[model samples]
Target: MTEVRGRMWVRGEPADGFTFSAISDCLTSEDTLVWADIYDPDHDTLTALAEELKLNMWAVEDATAPNERTKATVYRTHTFFTVYAIQMLTAVGDSTSTLVKHRISAFVLPRGLITVRLPPVAGDDPGFGMDEVSQRFDELGGQQYGVGALVHGLLDVVVDGHFDAVQDLDDGIESLEDELFDEDGPKRGLQRRTFRYRKDLVELRRVVLPMREVVSAIKSRRLDAKTSPELNPLYDDLYDHVLRASEWTESLRDMVTTVFETNLSLQDARLNTVMKKLTGWAAIIAVPTAITGFYGQNVEYPGLNTVAGFVVSSALIVLLVAVLYVMFRKRDWL
Candidate 1:
């Protein structure tokens, strides 16, 4: 019931309410191109569209399933593309934001473009930003370029998302770098934050890395509705954005790794400093213990068992410890 069809752009003229039931009716003139947007369709609805549109059964299966990796698969009459649209949620304190991937599947048919958006998942799943996608489509106005225009607009939206997510991750890494040096910052949280960055980047990279192949597959003119030579420049621009996102993420992953290793090094240095201070103090205290043991011997030569000898021994112990203390303090070993 949430399903809705967008106003069709035929050549340069706009028409509305081209339902799936009536899809068999002629919507495509030589210059007419139909674009349909479906949201969270039920099983019966998908089956019905598949029957009417002659969508490949395997492609329909993949469309309904969640968690499909980003890919492009070519069918006889249509090409199916699986792509993710990303939305970020900010976390509390110094931690980086969370990334929510909304799964989107598209079928590039000969005469039209069909976009199927999965429903929002539980928790902080930011549903696909349909408004931005719609705004991009609306920009077509009178310059409709058939199905190519629709596919271009939609892919443009998705690629921009990848770029934004990568940039946000870069910013998060920069913030983490600042806290890494701060003396008063929470050491434990910094460690956890870096780990989070590594994890998030891995996930982001997984989603983003395949986008190059997906976009390239389309730009290479393998699909029925692949970019025309006129639209090749646009697809090339999109490919450039994809490449930048992929490369930036690669460098960020290494940065996160460095942060983790540097934290370990810092911790080891701190432990060594603490252990050195403890050993110096223990050495200073041992001088008194050894003097007392010497004085307690049964057979002694110098003033054995006398009050004057006891005072002299005590004074010598105090003077020796004081000298050691001064030396240790001056050397900063205590």
Candidate 2:
């Protein structure tokens, strides 16, 4: 699917077709500011656009590839940027799984912006949606500012998403911490929760950390001369957001680690307590076992024929066990 926004430069009006020919004609006929958004463009479409825009073959190939790391690269007359958009799906069983990420690639030029997106699976929301953003841009009269404002708007949405995801992770960690420390309550699946949160944090970091460098490159004005000066500040703001997101991700990872360690320590302590109790009970039972074993002998034993002997022996076993229990209790060992 292809979407075109904005008016023709020559006619100063919105253009119709978003194809390579239409866009090239619009750019040539007049100085129109247009944006062409492509969703999973076909091979032929990609090749045609690359040829028309003179995009590097390597960069085009990279854009088509899956799970490419987030980064920005500058080529002659155009700048290419790839970024990941993350969305948290519903919590499944013990873990909260995230929907597959969308890899969005943008070709930034002076007159127009071309974006390529990988469509989401059925019933999944595309991480980057332009409905609200487009409305906001139109409300602000975005045509006057060209594509720079549009780029900023889109990035702003992505940054907000990061903030929400981080906040959810923090909430999950806090809940796990409470469960870990609960004295009278069962842990209630806390181990599984912590493991799941850790996994999500790792994945989120992988997507967000490299975006810092991508945004910084743009803010540093390292792109080709065709990039508009007005876009620099927007990129700088986006860079700041990326830095903040990275910091939050790092902090969340540390918290997950701490939660895991604390859980292990708590489990170890519980095990030790159980072992101590079992050891105490074993010691208490040993005296009876020893006394009975001696009295059960068939050989000529004095205790075998006498009721007094049996009573004395039984009394001795009970007394010995009581004494041992008292000693253990006094020493705070049980």
Please tell me which predicted candidate would have the highest lDDT against the true structure: 1
Off by over 4 Å in 1: 24-27, 92-97, 140-143, 222-228, 292-315, 326-332
Backbone clash pairs for candidate 2 read: 7-13, 7-14, 8-13, 9-31, 9-32, 10-30
| Residue 254 displacement in candidate 1 (angstroms) | 0.9
> What's model 2's TM-score?
0.85
Tell me how candidate 2 scores on lDDT. 0.73
Off by over 4 Å in 2: 1-21, 29-31, 121-128, 139-143, 184-189, 222-235, 301-303
Tens digits of per-residue lDDT for model 1, 44-148: 888888888788988888998978889998777888999999877777654554878888898887667788888877655667757777688777442355666
Let me know the TM-score candidate 1 reaches against the reference structure. Answer: 0.87
Task: Name the best candidate (by TM-score).
Answer: 1
Candidate 1, position 217, lDDT: 84
Looking at model 1, report the run of 10 residues with the lowest lDDT sum: 221-230
